[model samples]
Target: AEIAGEYLKKGSQVYVEGRIRTRKYQDKDGNERYSTEIIGDRMQMLGARAGSGEPREPAAAKGEAKPAPAKKPAGKFDDLEDDIPF
Candidate 1:
């Protein structure tokens, strides 16, 4: 929450990177227990200031473009073979 409060700006989309951390603590009965949290490593701003609510992909380290969509045959499924036993 603290990291979000610090880095997140109003109407701006933010992405955070962190690792899970588990720590031991003492309860009221003096029993040892553990709690987990995400320790932030890095953060980035992606979305626009208009708050359009569109999800943005995470930034690549090398700023590489995503792979193009695979191509499909023009023929329909009905044009294919039917080897099934009905």
Candidate 2:
């Protein structure tokens, strides 16, 4: 609520991860209208910030390295035992 109310402008580009629903309702004039609502579980603001010219990036793509599992090998035979006869 705070982010949308304070940070987002009328044309702010955002990526929303959520379920969307489209419902049909009648207006006061008895005219049919379709409304789409997004229930965003996750939302990200795209493009530059309020004043910054440079575009922003997601946290994972911003050079944050995730430590891989210790047991993972670089190659198929990388884990071969030294005592293997084959």
Candidate 3:
């Protein structure tokens, strides 16, 4: 909740690492319901905080929990126009 309450703004970018979890529950009406959520084990802010260039670090919920260090993206990027034939 700390991360969401703090850095997760409408346009803020974020990187999340975690697992998908689906659970069954009931709402106010007591009707059966299902919720699928990403249980973010670690989350990192994508860019710098507003009005500053220093990037914000991740916030950890677990004990002794500090945010994960800034790391390179695990995914690969494809060449955009470089591979295109003119």
Best by lDDT: 2
TM-score of each: 0.45, 0.48, 0.45
- The pairs that clash in candidate 2 are none
lDDT of 1 by residue, 1-86 (tens): 77667756677667677899899999999999999988878777776534566666666766678887879858988997898777
Candidate 3 on 1-86: residue-level lDDT in tens? 78688767888888878999999999999999999988888767777789887987656555766659879766546634466577
What is the full ranking by TM-score, best candidate first?
2, 3, 1
lDDT of 2 by residue, 1-86 (tens): 68877989999888877899999999999999999997888778888887888898755535669767889547667666789677
Report residue 85 deviation for candidate 3 (angstroms).
21
lDDT of each: 0.75, 0.81, 0.78
State model 3's lDDT.
0.78
**Candidates arranged by lDDT, highest first:** 2, 3, 1
Question: Higher-lDDT candidate among 1 and 2?
Answer: 2
Q: Least lDDT summed over 10 consecutive residues: which range in candidate 1?
A: 48-57
Counted clashes in each candidate structure: 0, 0, 0
